[model samples]
Target: GNNSGNLANISLDDILNERVKELYWEGFRRSDLIRYGKFTGDNYLWPFKGGVLSGQGVAAYRNLFPIPASDIIANSNLVQNPGYN
Candidate 1:
């Protein structure tokens, strides 16, 4: 119960690791990494991130989920998300 450590001493990496440990199964990892600017680019990567065994930075547009093809087809005004179409 003694969570009195100085928050300033906590590194971003520590915070990210803790979030991963605490919220791994809740599906927040992607969003968390994205919020920390680690979801794209070379800042962060794990095994198979982009179907590579060593991991790799993905395109920036990957940060947003792609609009469904069906939805775009149904609505001519709807544009497929960049990098998805």
Candidate 2:
């Protein structure tokens, strides 16, 4: 029963924003952005796991992962995510 034919005007951003609203606190943003190629680039890098960072140096550009706040607080050797601190 759909008409108007305006559905094609919808963009990925529109879909993502809606999904973000629905899943905001459920911890799905990271996966969604990465799968959609919305994560990474000049402004975004996933956080490094503090345990890994403590065992290894701050990850190189190619090796980044999300570290929960608790992990960072537990490991003094671990560095916070670049932009977060």
Put down candidate 2 lDDT per residue, 3-71, tens digits, no spaces.
865565777888888998998899988688668765654233334533343332332332346577899
The C-alpha lDDT values of all candidates are 0.88, 0.62
Off by over 4 Å in 1: 1-8
Residues 1-85, candidate 1, lDDT per residue (tens digit)? Answer: 2378546466889988998999988999889888989999977889999889999998899899998888888999998888987
Q: List the residue pairs that clash in candidate 1.
A: none
Off by over 4 Å in 2: 1-8, 43-85
lDDT of 2 at 23: 89
Highest TM-score: give the candidate number.
1
